[model samples]
Target chain A: MAWVLEDGRPIYAQLVERLQVQIVSGAYPPGGKLPSVRELAAVAAVNPNTMQKAFAELEKSGLIITQGTNGRVVTEDERLIRGSKRRLARRHADAYFAGMEGLGYTRAQAADFLRAAEGKGEAEDE
Target chain B: MNELIEIVGLTKAYDASHIAVNNVSLTLPRGKIIGLLGPNGSGKTTLIKMLNGLLTPTQGSIRIGGQPVGVETKAHVAYLPDRTYLSGNKKVTQILDFFCDFYADFSRERAVGMLQSLGVDPNARMGTLSKGTKEKVQLILVMSREADLYILDEPIAGVDPAARDYILRTILNNYDPNATVLISTHLIGDVEQVLDEVIFMRYGHLVLYTSVDNIRERHGKSVDAYFREVFAC
Candidate 1:
């Protein structure tokens, strides 16, 4: 499926993450119309009811707005989108560190490894 | 959402001996697809039969739309048994007419439209079509109803993956928004994504009533994987 769901998390949570990324990353641009619950549900291969719950979460976070029966639209507020992006980045970093910790690596080592990998790519470009 | 189905202390026992369905109480809300799941001999079939009025409960009660299971309730519920109850020597079109004559809610245009899409020959006899095609036709019939509760027993059991997808989509497209669809199946993986909630049964007892996503979130496993672990021998 286009939407990948990780294990050990409610679909609502995964949906929130995926849609948050979509909004912040401009896959769903600010002020763009969001797919209806049924459309999104079919795309994700989930029940429409579950999809509704996900949309409700997005609305609560101010990442999407539902204007009566006009359906949902991505929030036009740039600050909200930026906040979502920052929060998502921090969560990703925390997860990366946690996974590295499982492999017996310290936060400093993980950061050094990431920088070294980025430098190698830059050097290849040069 | 109102309670579409309410079962209070429901049980079905044979001769006061073997309990097919133990005393169970549950309320299924409208406008959701609920999976009734279990292994062999888990009272799943019995529970469904009771809901559809095919078999009367030995004790307690089942209420549909605030009314007990009876003639009025039967009108509001559409049931697709594991076997195609409509199979006959007649041609496919004739059977469509039969359903239209029988079920006031059956829509001839919708059913014929689906049949046309599937390329089912209207003149073909029921015995002539392939097993998969016949299953698809039967599914189309069940979904043509505008009933409040749809009880589908093993709708995806024998179909191929492509046919299964078509069947699930047909169900999603044809349901009334306020209706409840209770599908009984062992094919958990194929149907999990479409189910809003799941009811698990074992040995004629209600074991778990949970959402498919809840199972994923809490156990880190799909409904199929969890079923395997829960019913492991």
Candidate 2:
């Protein structure tokens, strides 16, 4: 839900990705109201117009919708959210495997690392 | 909501030999915060003065809201000069009164509210206040006006980092959504985030005028970093 942007990328694109995370992760609950452009821009410390652009992109992606006087709300479409989450996971996995390959690890070794990391997390839980 | 300000072949020279601003043409749309950025003595002040009608342009046309730079445009612009414009002897409250009397858009309530938040005493004499306090007072007066364009010059120059943060936040929060704010400063790092577009100048010639997002995406650098590389000596 927090917005942290690196310098080189377009800010609105980053904002769109961040908002997608918020919506798909249920931090902004389905059918819940979204903050005003000015409010969100202030929070992100970015120009309001830039935030507007991000919101427009999010709306276009079906993650958010405006309901007349109701302003903008997280889409009630559960399938859309689930689909977006899966897509993001796929993109991340692709990048992770690519990075691991660059570091001389095969896909099987990368999967083993993930399993080991998951086992370590369970151990910490105990 | 149309073009708020337009400059066509705008040029300025103190004498026939040396030009301070040279044949710069640009259009500023309504409701955007523009950063006029350049190094020292890059003619930022001269261009601002021409826009405010404080100084006459040598040649070319400058229009605001389709009108030439005259009383009408003057009334529509809220200008914060690089230095204190108010006489040092006047009390802060008296200066506020003067602004209210002169500009129809001036809101005494807004001025007072802004002053209170910045911890500026209205009753204090301008001459007696410290340098930073004076800048805050000037900001309060300028932002009080409901003008269509606000031209702020070196607003963060003299202040400390803490005060600079406050000034940037105030600028972001205060302006009406329809009013265009054009701020001229060399302190790119501090104001880069809030700026929608930036106008880069070098030796009085505009080198670039582009959106911050585009500069970030295309140049692969922060505005400050790009500025350093572009204007590197």
Candidate 3:
């Protein structure tokens, strides 16, 4: 999939978010080697330095580990991945509720709408 | 050694009445891609020409790798002007040969590879090629050099949207890690993501020099958006 980065935010931060989603979705499976900064930067058409900064952030959060000369790899810890997935889902839910609120729906009303949509199979899981 | 290019009180005057670049001082570090952005008649071209030693500065000084802008600096600086300067009568291979003979750092193999990939005919005269094709050839020659600094003026100006992506990627993958690349263009949105920092010029004066991310963080807008606000009429 093409990288979708929004304006008005730091590119490196957006790259970090994209990588997190990829890790949680098994697009970059646990223990898989990550592409080099130059390769990834070229693919995204962004500065390699910015891409490097994003990798450093991912390393700090323990989502990726550097193997010194062997390059970087996704963490092998399944629990950590699950935790990140849960956090991502919660963030999406929050955004959904916020949008619903902007449209004049209360929290309870938004929840009811979601349940009704699910019952009709209109909100199928990806 | 960290700062690859330094300008002190740089000024260029067209005559007694007009000043193109006015008392500008800047220090650019190595190993980064920087944008030199401004609107029309903002002196971006003047500053770039001075850096390449193509035009003389009326006052102040510019140093690349601690050497003043001169013949010595020219050898290490790969420059692509906004317009094509190659002779129209010459074949692409002849221009390639000229670059090979002129710049010791030029890579004939690399230029050939790029020309082949772009499907630019080397045996054809430069006059017969399309404007976009000519720009690609020029870019290939400039980027094939292993220089300390690369100054490109509106490198993406005439290219199509698809070719713009190719040009940006070429810059990203080719530049030496320790060298600095300074690109001057008014199309901020096209090159915003690739820039580490940007220098804004307005009315011959340096207005703002800051990181791309910093602009986004501080102003809650992209560099392109911020530029529009700052340069709005």
Question: What interface root-mean-square deviation (Å) does model 3 yield?
Answer: 0.7
Full-model lDDT, candidate 1: 0.87
Q: What Cα-based lDDT does every candidate model obtain?
A: 0.87, 0.88, 0.92
Give me candidate 2's TM-score against the actual structure.
Answer: 0.92
Chain B TM-score against the true chain B, each candidate? 0.97, 0.97, 0.98
Assess the local accuracy of residue B23 in candidate 2 as a C-alpha lDDT between 0 and 100: 91
Q: Which lDDT tens digits does candidate 2 get at residues B52-159?
A: 998999999999999999999999899999987789989999998899899999999998988898888888999998898888788878888999999999999998
Q: What CAPRI-style quality would you assign to candidate 1?
A: medium
Q: What TM-score against the true fold does each predicted structure earn?
A: 0.91, 0.92, 0.97
Separate clash counts for every candidate: 0, 0, 0
CAPRI quality of model 3:
high
Q: Taking the tens digit of each residue's C-alpha lDDT, what string does model 1 give over B24-80?
A: 999899999999999989999999999988999989899999999999998888888
Which 10 residues in a row give candidate 1 chain B its minimum summed lDDT? B168-177
Q: Is candidate 1 or candidate 2 better by lDDT?
A: 2
Candidate 2 DockQ, CA atoms: 0.63
i-RMS for every candidate: 2.0, 1.1, 0.7
- Per-residue accuracy of model 3 over A11-101 as CA lDDT, tens digit each: 9999998889999999999999999998898888889899999999999989999999999999999999999999999999999999989
User: Candidate 3 lDDT, tens digit per residue, B1-233?
Assistant: 79999999999999978999999999999999999999999999999999998899999999999999898999999999998889999999999999999999999999999999999888999999988888888998999999999999999999998888888888998957889999998889989989999999999999999999999989989999999999999
